[model samples]
Target: MNNKSITAFTLLTATLLFSLIAHADIINTNTTGRNTFSHRLSNLYIPEAVGGETWFDDQNQYNKLDIVASGTAAYADITVAGTVVGTTAEGANIYATDNSGIGIAYELNYSTPGATSPQYAYVYPNKLTFNGSGYSLNGYMHLKYALVRLTQFVPAGPITQLPTVTVNYHNLGASGYPDLSVVTLQGISAQPQITACNINAPGSITLPPVNGNSLVEGAQGITDAPQITLTNCPGAINNIIYDFAATYYNTHSYVNGIFTTKQGDGYAKNVYIQLQDATGTGIHINSPLTLPGYTGSGNYAIPNFRIAYFIDSGTLNTVTAGKVETAIDFTVIYN
Candidate 1:
């Protein structure tokens, strides 16, 4: 009876050891019991356009952290939790932060022998597989981040804390595997100041009267030079762009900066208003013009811009003497 009891005890011990081993296929050996990834954007220049486009930092690839899981071959489903601000064209997720008009995108790369190169995917929700034999459940897993321009970011001042995103790795319904591992994705810190500029434009511009007989076909009659000033512009802005639009009417004549005057009994006939530079060069309406070397806080006057009246080449002999008036609007763009 004693010999039989010894054999049974040995068999029971072996079964328990096997069970323990089977349940310990995956292990979390993170010394700190947590994971974090951070990125810094110093003096980041945001794009001025607001058309649902994304911009990544130059050092996005290097902005990463290592996450390690030790033990045996398994798979983990990765997910994230945060305020989703927007999405990329390729369907990647963009998370919001404390700063307005800025967002962050997360990416993950799995390093396995089966992969000829690093397999990368946006960390919205993805699965990572550990299929290599003798590979460390302890080996490092790399996670990267990038700064995406969700919209035109015009910060009020220096940027401080953005926010954090919670990333989770779970092995649900998988027998003997760890349930979950959490990683916190930190927001980018930056010091970029974007200032708002005001356009000081003339409400109306009036030209001097001209003799009707002196106005020949295609000849300019009267002219006025108006200055459009930009005020409260900050030095942080590299340059400024501006364009003009006709507010009164839409006609093919706008291509030559010509507009029809207000219709009335005394309104000018066979004569139209034109806009031109001081050098008499015709100004293309709705075309963007960049202000060169515009960097500072001061008043900037639009150079060489003027308006004039010209005889309608279409009606050469029927020029009438009357009022010639029109309105124009201008828009300023900067970053």
Candidate 2:
């Protein structure tokens, strides 16, 4: 009975243990960063031909994501999911808008500490991997659009309300699979006008050979009028402004409409060239002139334009000629 009581009195002790683990979520702390960007296609002055040119590029402009995480650094994969409008000829993704001839292109980039270069993915459904430690994420959106001459047409006026696509970024490693952000990039607001014109000018204009002895100072020697024809002009244009410049000049003098010729070997000496209007009025070089009665979309011959060889009030008696050749440069501005 004593042994049984001693055995029953023997103390019994038990220990219960519990373990707890903590996990920190990855978060973008830059709350004030803008997610919506506006782009304007008209301001780029895109050419009529389909060349797959980048009309708008936000590479310099980026929405930065300041990532903060707590735990042992681990690799996490991020993905992009959005509505793909189409693909470019080079196989790049195109996020289209309500406006035609203009669309969006996007890329996701990630960088970690001591990384030589950042990792980027432009094509959709692509995953970008990053270390869960201190890292950065940048989202870039651009406009690398092509113009379809047959199907797409420029708007009559500037478009303000250009619809865009909504893109979602997901953290595949996050618990329950949470979205990093929902972004909608808006195109830049601008009043863009596309005015294109094709010019037809002779490669070289020749004047009748004249005798240098028959010319006097401050008098015209040989005169000629060459035509500058502008064709394939869009009907939406209102005016065409043009100006001229001398390629080779002996001196920096372009006083009235006269510019000096090159004064070296194979060049005429004491000789000058002058630009004039139809009334023989000396038109100032580099002065912009608007085409008269320019309606739109047709072939037009520039009026009141004439080029002539003249001698200035300098030493005309020493007018020795070897070759009286010069070049003229012209620029046309369409509005």
- Which candidate should be chosen as best, given lDDT against the real structure? 1
TM-score of 2: 0.50
Poorly placed runs, candidate 1 (over 4 Å): 1-194
Model 2 Cα lDDT, one tens digit per residue, 1-335? 45553445668899988885543434343342446655444544534554344433443444544444544322222232334566655455665444444444554444343221224444553234444434433423222222222123433223344445344443434434345443445555543455557788878867666676677776365465668888766543457788878876632245567777766788788777777777777777787888886754456778747767777676787788767777778888865
> Can you give the lDDT of residue 42 in candidate 2?
55
TM-score of every candidate: 0.45, 0.50
Top candidate on TM-score is: 2
How many backbone clashes does every candidate have?
A: 5, 5
lDDT of all predictions: 0.56, 0.53
Give the alpha carbon lDDT tens digit for every residue of 178-250 in model 1.
5556555565544443545777777887787787666776636546666777875643345678877778755
Whole-structure CA lDDT of model 1: 0.56
